[model samples]
Structure formats: C-alpha cells, structure tokens
Target: MFYISCTYKIMATFLYKCRDVGYDCGFEFSAHSRDDLMPRIRIHSRYAHNIYEMTDEMKKKVEEAIKQID
Candidate 1:
C-alpha cells in the first residue's frame, strides 16, 4: 500500500519506425522499455526481412531511432 502510494508514473515508451531505418517494411513497435521491444523487433526482422544479425552499431542506430512518448 505504501509503495503504491509512493509510486510515480513512469513514462518510458519506446517507438520505432521501419521506414525511418530506410525500409519499406511498414512495421512499427511500441513498448514501455527497450528490453521489451527488442525481442519482438528481432524476430520480426529475421522472419519478415531475413535480417539475421544486428551489429552493435546497428543496435545503436535502432536505439537512436526510438522515440519517447509521454
């Protein structure tokens, strides 16, 4: 009860657009955290686009592409 009362709203949404990454994939994903969003994006990238691997720089690019929504 105390914890709940003390809790503040966390606005931690992440947004990614496939087109922003120069793809016609037309896919977008949103989640509360990067950890929550990456797995789904990885699976989608692999199965849908045959993108099997993401380099550290590519991961950084993806992270850069993410937008925060309040």
Candidate 2:
C-alpha cells in the first residue's frame, strides 16, 4: 500500500517601486499579485497626482515594472 499527499505553496509577494517607471511620488506598492496592486496605484494617483484615470499604455508600463519580492 502507498499513500501520497499533494500540496502546493504559492508565493504571493511582489514589489513595485514607484520610481521604477520614472515617477517621483516616493511610493512603493507590494501585493500578492500585480492585479491587486493596480487599483491601489490608481487611487494613489487620483489623490496624489490628481489623475482620475490611467491610460492603457500607462497600465502596461506599470505591469512591466513589477518585480517579485521574496
């Protein structure tokens, strides 16, 4: 007889430096995934930069700058 157990570990931590994309807001965002960080950034941008909406290209830029952190 043989017994087997299956388990998986998910690493859910990433670091997104605001300055990476050439923004000097002095803000850094960390989240389980990039999908989670975007909204926070958008809100921050709204209050900090007074930008109500982000362009598609800007969003792409942000996605590109995200780096996983352990």
Candidate 3:
C-alpha cells in the first residue's frame, strides 16, 4: 500500500526488561517486520518500557543482557 511504500524501515525498541521479578521478563528492541509491530519483542504489563530506558544501573544491566542476545 501507499503507507508501506513510504516507510523505508522502522527501528525496534525493546520497550522493557522482564527480570528480578517472579518470572523471566523483559523486551528486546528489534525492528518490526512487514507483518509484525515488534519483530523480536513481546509486550507485557510488567516491563512497561525497555530496561535500557530505565535510569537505575541495575535495571539497565538487565536490559543490556537482553540486547547482547540480539
């Protein structure tokens, strides 16, 4: 479609990191493909935002680990 043509590409943003809680948690910021909004991440209520976005050093560390995987 016209919109698709206009968009060259979209950068993925790991909206959050899922860790230090009851279960493994967090998100990875990998660009979305044609059929996906976030190609490599899944949304969860706990994460809220990418762990990297967090100001806390410890939390950021968690996010960094996720990034390394990508």
Best by TM-score: 1
Candidates' RMSD to native: 4.1, 3.0, 9.9
lDDT of 2 by residue, 1-70 (tens): 9999989898779888778878886898899988898888888878987879888888887888889977
1-70 per-residue lDDT for model 1 (tens digits): 3554476888789898877777787899999997888898889879988989998877888888788887
Q: What are the per-residue Cα lDDT tens digits for candidate 3 across 39-59?
A: 233344234544333346544
Clashes of each: 0, 0, 8
Residue 26, candidate 3: C-alpha displacement in angstroms: 7.7
Worst 10 residues of 2 by lDDT: 16-25
TM-score per candidate: 0.78, 0.76, 0.24
Q: Rank the candidates by TM-score, best first.
A: 1, 2, 3
Among all windows of 10 consecutive residues in model 1, the one with the lowest summed lDDT is: 1-10
CA lDDT, every model vs. true structure: 0.84, 0.84, 0.38
Off by over 4 Å in 3: 1-7, 20-56, 66-70
Distance from true position, residue 31, model 1, in Å?
A: 0.4
